[model samples]
Target: MTMTFIIVYVVIALILVGLVNLFMSKRKRKMKTQRTEQTLSENDTSHQSYQSKFNIRDTDETSEANDANAISEENGKLNISNNSDETEALTSDQNAVTQHEESHTQEEEINEKLKQKHSAFMFGKGTSQGKVLIAMIFGMFIAILNQTLLNVALPKINTDFNISANTGQWLMTGFMLVNGILIPISAFLFNKYSYRKLFLVAMTLFTLGSLVCGISGSFTIMMVGRVLQAIGAGILMPLGTNVFMTIFPPEKRGAAMGTLGIAMILAPAIGPTLSGYIVENYHWNIMFYGMFIIGLISLAIAYIWFRVYQVTTNPKADIPGIIFSTIGFGSLLYGFSEAGNNSWTAPSVVITLLLGVVFIVAFVIRELTMRVPMLNLEVLKYSGFTLTTIINMIVTMSLFGGMILLPLYLQNLRGFTPLQSGLLLLPGALIMGFMGPIAGRLLDTIGIKPLALIGTGIMTYATWELTKLNMNTTYSHLMVIYIIRSFGMSFIMMPIMTAGMNSLPQRLISHGNALSNTLRQLAGSIGTALLVTVMSTQTTQYVSTYSQDLDKTNPFIKDRLQEMAQAMGGEQMATQKILEFVQKLASINGVNSAFLVATALSALAFILSLFLRGKEHYISKE
Candidate 1:
């Protein structure tokens, strides 16, 4: 149904545009014919005047021999009159030609404006590259809105479903899974379609998904809606990065992308807080509905300000590449999803992990051998690009890993509500949002490598600090650490993207962008899953070990257990209290360990950045 809808709309749009072109062409031909007739009339008048002057000169020769001096003066006066008439006619012809030329020039300028307007949909429109910057800003805002809008609604969803923290996180995990699976596919689709049409389609789908989510009565239905929205996000997220690079000349890509980074970092960070406020004051459904409205507005802009009817050469789909990507990514995420519920030793978890590994291996082999590949593996031949991509992956892993772990820690262990947990992220998000653009402007003057190194170093240090948090840590302390950590990310994110893209050839920007976005998605998936799985495993182990020491015979243990029971006051409540305490304490310890691992990941990113060679700015077009 979606495919058919897209095709029909594109055809109708093109037909209308074809008619407009036809009208303009016919008008130009008519004007050209009229100008030709006027030029012919001017030539005939000039020829007649030349013949009269010759006739008068021959007659004067005969008359001057007969009448002498008196007739000579009369002949001179007649010659002056003829010359004056010829000069007046010549001036009149010149004026007519000049007026015709001016009209033609005006028409050509009008045609150029029409051409620019037509190109705006597919390639975007502007004289000074300002439109490229504007499109990027819009893309950035949309990306941020997609994720952040869900934050406030997560708690309401959890409470309504009566689910565990792990189960409730599916709101986020489901979106990630769908988005992760489709990123490569988006790359293929983007190349095969017009940018304006694709963007509008994405926005429309997103809006429809939001409406579906708002009306859903069941968890399954809501998840289905989320899946729909994820498809749009999957495409747009990558599109935003690549489109800017394609629209702008190489020299300004960093500055442009840097401006985009503000929205990128700001969205996820702010999503939770805004979601919290909306859900708390109103209802969860309202949040989704609001997103729907925003999507519609974007769609309207696309229709009015852009043209989406350009044709494309449909490349053969890479079947092997698609299979490998789907299976590899699908199985990997499945393993993580299962780990949230099932033990690592469980048959289901084991099988999923094994399949994921096998598919990933197959994907690598297929990409290496294909002639016209979906993912161009040849770019990896450049050492700087390869290392930079790896670093990007590592950085995203740690960033997303913490995004998952931190919220869970606050809600499950510290007994904070969803609103409070989201609030906790606000300060960090605010700091990073403001800093992103500043970093971009700085990169324009200073080198990308230095800025990237400095940012990663701070991120590494921040990760180490996060590893030190425990159950008893104060909110104020966590807030300070999060702020510092976010500030560091603001520096690293834009510079790396700008530098790597700048290094690529102009023709390779699209492919390079596709690869970069794909890697970031992979990193987020791997990082989130690893963090969750490790926390779950370690928490269960800690609970079991501690249970052995909490026997009734141990005096200190007995006293502590009795005190907890008395604080609850009822037998049923006492048992529940003990279990909750055990779970909460275990989680705190597990999260600290995860943060330590994140620290290690950030360090690896730092090492990879060192291999990124010298800074490469986008090459300017002549």
Candidate 2:
């Protein structure tokens, strides 16, 4: 037992060490990527600035060319260069020059107007690529930390609350359900409020929620706190992506958004192990307490470094649109969240699902018809954007959906501690964490398709390996599987983001990004719900089948039962103990089979990834 404990400790430590290394490496990579992107943006700016001054010269050139053309038309009769001001201004002479120059000057003026509009849209006075990247990356960390920290703390919450296995899921499920509803509303808020203000508000809500959750005396209070965190998290998720597009140049947005994938992997990697330590040695509330402090620090940093005074605003609060988006997304997620606990055939489940569908459909019709739409549907006209968004949803479902199963299987079935289970996730989490940014950087050089293929291929293998896990599987075997899956996730995530953003106009970047992030969150929620439902249903079947051989009439079983009862203090107590033990054993096996179901979902994700198109690295046409 000591040896096993030591091994577990070592595994946990290694995973943390690996994650720290990966984090450090990504920071370094980010700096390097930032420098390169900055240099390119600077060069573009310099070229555009130079071209602006150069245009003054062109206006004069056009005037001179028109004068020459007039002179030729008159057989050198105009001689405007030598003429007196009064002579040159004569009606007959001026009219001749005006006739030749009229259409040409009008064309030049139109061209200049178009150029100014393009410049205003792409490089607004206050917006800078560097500033946007910084803000978005920070948002990424906040969003990720919010979700991942809770994952580690859930088990301790279950023990403390004395909740059922299914009830325990609400801690996670509720967060996602609330978060999903918040995402669509967030897009409108981003337009309505300053990004800096919205971000600070969200962080504040999250911090406050953490405090509430940490100090709560009852499950009800804890649930409310979780809801607070969800609200903040929902806003930040899409906002993070929006910031990237708004701030970064069209060409460099891929590398900027890639940082988010790194955050996604890193948050989960650190959250579980760190929270595990907190729960084991201290109180489970320590997770939220820690989150509160982190949130405060992030909030301060964001406010100080990222200014709100300069935030662009042309917001008209679309009350109708906001209502539709919230109700639509909220109902849909609620249905998924409730599905794991309630009978699928129950009226509540059916009614909630139907309501979800109705709201979503209404949201679509309303957004399309609105004169000033909150979500610009025009961006979806791009095939690359549409396809990548689908890919994002599928991958998110696979990754987040499968994540719900593995930890549960390790802890409930294999009897591993939270720390040990989290340690197991570390390898994959770290690898994938690094994979996303690296793939993002690679998007700078090669292309997205090959990287995506590589990612999907690894995921396929990892999913296949997952299908093979059983009750007696060793730690080493699981580690290998996680590593492959993490690497695949890293490869696939960035490419999908880059591909989608690459196809959009700079002005629509924020709206497009918001859509992508929203889908990713929805995918996670749906995936988690789907997997939980599968596991619960499948486990019931497995338990019934496994219990079949314990017939009461068998002579050997009957003799063994009598002997067991004799060994115990009394027959009555012995029978009770035997039944409890049997139920526990069945529960463990049931969880193991649930993981097998998760493996199948991942396999499905791999198949979907195959259909997605490759990288769309930006090359300026002009």
Candidate 3:
């Protein structure tokens, strides 16, 4: 039934495209004919005027020659007419015609300018570039949203599948690992294939993945679906970004990318909140089913809307590069991911991390030497792209890594409902969504440094505020800070990314996009791991310290315990309650410690912002 529906949908889509294309062709032909006729009429008038002037001159010369011939015949004397005035008039006529043509050309140039302005006003109406982005953003939105949605649904999924926490986490970890692996490969895919084919293939995989997940009865099948979704999503983002860079010029790129940033930030921000509501009321599969339906819609829109921006070309594959990238990024991401659950120093984590570093080094060396690299390292030679990429990684870590801390504090420590926890983030997400375009405009006007500094400053302040969170911290307080933080974020991400990408030459855009994404992915994973490690390690220390400090023999603790025991059923129950309280205190302390680290990261980004500028001009690509 699904296959049949898809086939029918495609048939309908093709018919619709045929009609639209027909209309577009007719409109274009009519416009072309009008321009041609107008040009011909102008040319004919100019030609006739020139011909008439020459004819007048010729007639005078002819009459004069006839008279001269008669004189010569009658008296054997020769005569000639100078006719300088006629010659001057003919020269003047030629100048007038040239000026008329120049003026007409100017008018046409002005008309073209007007058309461009009108197109800009319409936000790329009657343009395939706009339609492509519009369609792709939907897929990007759902794919990124899928990343966070499962975070909220994991508890329910765990119960349904009868899995352990570590086991359930693989659903998230596996998705990240797969996504990280595919991102590097996507740049190669982009260079070798047209945008249309890649978009259709990516959306198909994503939509199919959603279907698999929606119907999965076990964890193994669910993992398969998640991996499929990851592969599709991983390609969609960099591809969309590269297409944007290809179509929009530098001046317009900031605003255009900023527009895309809405989907980039908003989708993940609202995912958990939306997922929370669904998980609270519906079955876990509903989330996947919802994705499946939306994915189909997005796929259809993409099919109808996308244009072929780049034609397929053969690029020599680097097998060594591929192997190194897969092992390096995959192992590194897995290491960071597991570092959160297991300690950083665990044998497996240590081994994988070391292996990742070694392979990544080899990969970099391979790319640097290769004539046709799998992932180009030449983009890094531009100081502007290099700097922005570093700052981007830092900002991503501080921004996304810090995001997880709130949910942990709200839901686990404070016992807030998942919906309530998600709602806490809703206001912030909405703020970023609203401000993305505004910041884009700001980026174009004020420049990259100003926005970067201002954003970092606000983010630093907001993250500093999070360190003050405690058992009694008000929910409103958290929401307010997150909103402010979101505002700061709106200015930081897109502008910085655009500046970096814009710094690269046209040929290197794909490489720059891929490398930037690869690093950002690593940073997010590492940041999350680092922050979680700090929390876990600190919590354990705090628990031990609290236990040691609250000695049973101490008069102070003894008095408190007696009063609690007298009020409660027994001393043992009071002791248990005290232990639980101590554990909560330790956990909050650990959370605060994590926030402090995040604050420092944000501050470091702020300091780095001082050095940030707009895209640098390329001396040469080689």
* RMSD values, in order shown: 12.7, 11.4, 9.9
Model 1: which ten-residue window has the lowest total lDDT?
1-10
**True-structure lDDT of candidate 1:** 0.70
The lDDT values for all models are 0.70, 0.68, 0.80
lDDT of 3: 0.80
Using all chains and alpha carbons, the TM-scores for the candidates as numbered come to 0.73, 0.75, 0.80
**By TM-score, highest first, what's the ranking?**
3, 2, 1
lDDT of 3 by residue, 1-622 (tens): 2223223322432343234335434544565566557656766775676668667756766676686557546543444444774586468557756755775676567656644442221223345667877887888899889998998899889999999887788788777777777788677777655666677878888899999999999998997798778878888889878888878877778888888898899998888888999988989899999999999999888767775443334565566787788778878888888888788888778877997899899999998898888888988888888988999999989877788888999998999998899888988888888888788777767778889899999999999999988889999888999999888888898889988887888778889999999999999988999999999999999999999999999999999999999999799999999999999999999999999999999999999988875433312233
Q: Top TM-score: which candidate number?
A: 3
Q: Count the backbone clashes (under 3 Å) in each candidate.
A: 4, 3, 0
Runs off by more than 4 Å, candidate 2? 1-136, 152-174, 212-227, 307-313, 552-604, 608-610, 614-622
Higher-ranked by lDDT: 2 or 3:
3
Give the range where candidate 3 is weakest over 10 consecutive residues by summed lDDT: 1-10
Stretch of 10 with least lDDT, candidate 2: 1-10
Model 1: clashing residue pairs? 121-307, 148-271, 152-275, 152-276
Give candidate 3's error at residue 331 in angstroms: 0.3
Candidate no. 2 TM-score: 0.75
